[model samples]
Target: MTVELRVLPPLLVSLAVTVVLAACTRVPPPPPPESREGFPERGARLIQQYGCGGCHTVPRVPRAEGLVGPPLTRFGARSYIAGELPNNAENLRRWIQDPQSVEPGTAMPDLGVSETDARDIAAYLFTLE
Candidate 1:
């Protein structure tokens, strides 16, 4: 009597299906976009409109060329404002509203950002990191 062994093929196929299903089940969806609660798209537009990037190396703005001010690539992650005030949205807004008030000798000018604009700019800046 001769016995045929067809069991190995089915076992291999079952194992492959199990592996594929496992792989598919384990994958996670991508994370959602960062919150823009305080940051509005208009603020990003204003950043360009006001030419803030000309003096500061603002992220995501193009044609920005000026060496007058400090680079602001990581301004959001900074711990202090002008090396004095605590790094917070309110402080950033105040600084933007009036830089000289924060630091008497600082060369950063007041861009005439309104309360709303300042908030938006601060929100955008906070997203740098």
Candidate 2:
């Protein structure tokens, strides 16, 4: 009733280890394309008003070094939203406006962001690069 892994050679064991380590490592996604839809400056102010820094570690904004959520250092260069939705102006805006609609039970609460505010916030996020 004893199981033996001797059937697997040393080289196979090394290969398996290497594969597992590689899988555990995370590779940053390709940056999203640039666009000229929302206003970045306005978005920055809105970020402060929305208090997004309380959870996410956002750059530039004072006292925004929160560790509750992921750091938004190079958010503009990311390829996905909430690690699910495609990174685009519209999707970003939607997520900012109503995070609950995008992901149920997500820690990112819906802050009742107005459409205009969402657009501005998205614009500011895209400037993080």
What lDDT does each candidate get?
0.76, 0.84
Clashes per candidate, residues 3 or more apart or on different chains: 0, 0
Give the C-alpha miss distance for residue 53 in model 2, angstroms. Answer: 0.8
TM-score of 1: 0.67
TM-scores for the candidates: 0.67, 0.74
Best by lDDT: 2
lDDT of 1 by residue, 1-129 (tens): 122357777888999999999988955533322334476567677788888877887877776556788777766667777887877877778898999998997888887989888888778887777
lDDT score, candidate 2: 0.84
Cand. 2 TM to true fold: 0.74
lDDT score, residue 103, model 1? Answer: 96
